[model samples]
Target: MSVSNEPTLKPERPFFSSGPTAKFPGWSLDKLKTESLGRSHRSKIGKARLKYAIDLSRELLGVPDDYLVGILPASDTGALECAMWTMLGPQPATVAAWESFGNVWIQDAVKQLKLKNLTALDADYGEIPDLASIPQDNDVVFTWNGTTSGARIPNTDWLESGRSGVTINDATSAIFAQEMDWPKLDATTYSWQKVMGSEAQHGMLILSPKAIERIESYDPDWPLPKLFRLKKGGKINQGIFEGATINTPSLLATEDYIAALEWAKSIGGRQAMFERANENARILEAWIEATPWISNMVSDPAKRTNTGVCMVFGGDWYESLSDEDKAGVPKKIVSMLEERGVGYDFNGYRDAPPSLRIWCGGTVDAEDVKRLLPWIEWAFEEVKASHAN
Candidate 1:
């Protein structure tokens, strides 16, 4: 892909797109360039920085003292898979699937892991499955926020407090954008790209004391790959959850993660990040209310996501247009915005309804969202004008 020489069409406010969302406020490529490069990850200096990054994350997120945070391979997907394959089994499990990612976990549990006594509770993209009836004795897996569908569980109080089963939460897009009740969760996973505004290779896995206990005691009769091994003969591997990663991580990416953390801290930490996301979402909410054709995918106001704000067109806007023209609307709108260099990746997930998924995470400011909304309207108009016969 060749770089464009055309002058950038700066947005009046800012731009938003769901994942690999906007860069951290005031982030610069030069900052990444200046970071120490070509350092051995296991060396004392590298380890110290890596440990600092983990400690900083714990402090910023208000993670419990007993929980262990580890940097894993790939992104949130890898982190979730690691948790599923490692800790699940030897007991009946229940999966709550309301979105693409949660469904992926359901498939993994029933088909890949071959867990026979599993129950899958699901709903369409917009709402959560009824949690009131799930057995309290079975392990539960759910995504705290549905990045693809823009629906999120507003609270963790749904889980029975004294239940023996565990709760594994995929909180990739939820961590910084919303308040997470750490005490209510057992194993939580997130990615740097979603809320941290970093590269997508690193996954953060935090295991609570209860989660560690499960790993230490449960001896499931499943073969374990090196990547999925968290315990050895009922003994939890404490070192892996520390600075020691399963495989070598990109030192540069690690440095970038640290830089992103520093940037988060500089902006008044998690509360400030939450405020930024809420403010951006409010801007979009106002836009959605006034716009006749568009509305949020998540119907419930409280369940709506602050990050990954997805909007679907109303009524027969699609039926009115010819198939060829209708098929091209989303692509045309996305391309127009991209050509203007105002936003990227506003297109919805392939599996989702024909909608636009905008990023309202902390990395993006409200001003950017305000600017991008007008361009979105302009793009729709331009596309309609060109496509109209």
Candidate 2:
């Protein structure tokens, strides 16, 4: 019997989803086939590769020498939970929530941990709550970039330099894509799927000297989960900060992380990556200005994110359309682009206001973004055409 011939499925152009964003420019399936399979993470070879990856992260991000870098289980959520459960109880806490992820942390602190004396300062998606209102006496938690909202904190200037409280930063979408003032931060967490474009399930946890000191000197009275425990008797277990991950990790994932780091370095490191993201943002900014119905979700240009540039339909763009038309607009636009093979996941987050989120990260080429702009126009035209029918 003869089998019928058929073509396998493939994406023509890349998807520009906010995260689990884009892979390295030249990535291919063959790279994975050559990776070591069934290798123990504890093996000397595996440890070396892991160590090298951590070291490269430090060098590329310009993390201080005294800081500790470790690969954590899960993604940014795991890293943030570990810090909150382990290190937050020693002092009063203030959490600033401007977007979905920031609100998640606030929920963890208030509901999950049930910490009293916690102040939750929140703002709408496009704006930050007053930074001046944050208490200097309490440990502060905030995102450097609000990926879902497209708003970002301009810098660490709002933070008090000599404050006794530690600043924990959830920089999942900000790292490598924007400038981070590490000196003002105590503990910072990021995921592999963001700027680096590696697979998810891995997080990078960086602890400053002050953060390490807090872990070593301050004992939170809360019961610590094994996964969240980072210290004993006010001292960070050095092993956990080194190769001692709380749970077993995928060696294959670790190798991919290493490769991503190497790719980041070869592309002129952090500055180059920043430039790439910023350039992408500029391209979108130009288009947004020209488009009548579209506008950025972020109110302040100073705080607009280069990585995740979210846009909302202007005025009554939604209200003006019929209910069916409105409901189908975002879906149709995303589907049309995906079908055309020009862009993939550009849909705004469900929790966010109806909008489109384009990921303009380092791994995404500017030329691809330029190509994507025309497709976005075409997508809206298709949507309009459908509405007219």
> Taking the candidates one at a time, how many backbone clashes does each contain?
3, 3
Q: How close is candidate 1 to the true structure, as a TM-score?
A: 0.94
In candidate 2 the C-alpha lDDT for residue 285 amounts to 93
lDDT of each: 0.82, 0.82
lDDT tens digits, residue span 58-171, model 2: 999999889999888889999988888777877899999899999999999998888878999899989989988887889998988998999999877789887888999999
* C-alpha lDDT of candidate 2 relative to the true structure: 0.82
Residue pairs clashing in model 2 are 15-344, 216-234, 216-235
Instruction: Report the Cα lDDT for residue 370, model 2.
Output: 78
Highest TM-score against the true fold, candidate:
1
